[model samples]
Target: MSEKLRDQLVGAWKLHSYVEIPVDGSEPFYPMGEKPMGIIMYTPDGYMSAQLMKPGRAPFAVNDFYEGTLEEYKAAGSTYIAYTGPFKVNEQNRTLTHSMFISLFPNWMGQTQPRVVSIEGDVLTLGTASPISSKGKTVNSKLVWHRAQPE
Candidate 1:
């Protein structure tokens, strides 16, 4: 039986992989490096949160959150992504839009981003609706997620 897209999306999904495809067709890359870890969750109430991190980040010499050196802070910022906010689904085309109430990257804090979404079995694949500059290149982000199983 096929369920509505919204219904299918109301749950937690673990990150399987993430890739960025350059519009110029130069090359696709993974910003978080190999084996990135993350989770994206959607609630029936239309709220959502996503967090992704690069694997094996170096431990900060200082234990305090605010005590990291510039290099350490830069590494942390470049390796982690997080945002939480409300999301809306377009019933006409079954597309998704996420509005960031709070984001790790300040520029996205007030942005509403569109996502091209599809689901196959337990897999959910999300792609950027439009190209965006990333690492000095224009690219579309593709994130594949698998439905989380309860432990």
Candidate 2:
């Protein structure tokens, strides 16, 4: 991978959009709701983390994280996604892979997913190369992010 691309990815990006296009030609779905919010950060040391969620999610009735009601737990689980791991860039193919070391979705733990990547100025676009099962449908996920500006 070129150092330039690596350098470009080593920063924080705020999610602008996240859409899942089904393979069966159905309407696209927004897993994190219409106006989702997220942040992904890549470090120079090859570490990365991403946190995404639906906006305006209700708080659990109980303040304890592990003592929420079943409905509250389900709501929280269905509305959020988070993972942290190491990342690798394949500059030759303009692709990037994130190997999950930790993930809220247990199934994704230890899985390595590849994404087709492109950068234009401050926008970073990532598309899943393979369809992933979501909400009982196979879909390709596309996410757009904007580079975070220094405060």
Residue pairs with colliding backbones in model 1 are none
What is the TM-score (0 to 1) of candidate 1?
A: 0.97
Off by over 4 Å in 2: 1-3
Candidate 1: segments with Cα more than 4 A from true spot: none
Model 1 over residues 21-98: C-alpha lDDT tens digits? 999999899999868899999999999999999999998998999999999999999999999999999877899999
For model 2, how does the per-residue alpha-carbon lDDT over 82-136 read when each residue is reduced to its tens digit? 9999999877666799999999999999999998888999999989989999999
Number of clashes in model 2?
Answer: 0
Candidates in order have lDDT scores of 0.95, 0.93
Model 2 vs. true fold: TM: 0.95
Best-fitting candidate, scored by TM-score: 1
Question: Which clashing pairs does model 2 show?
Answer: none
Query: TM-scores of the models, in the given order?
Result: 0.97, 0.95
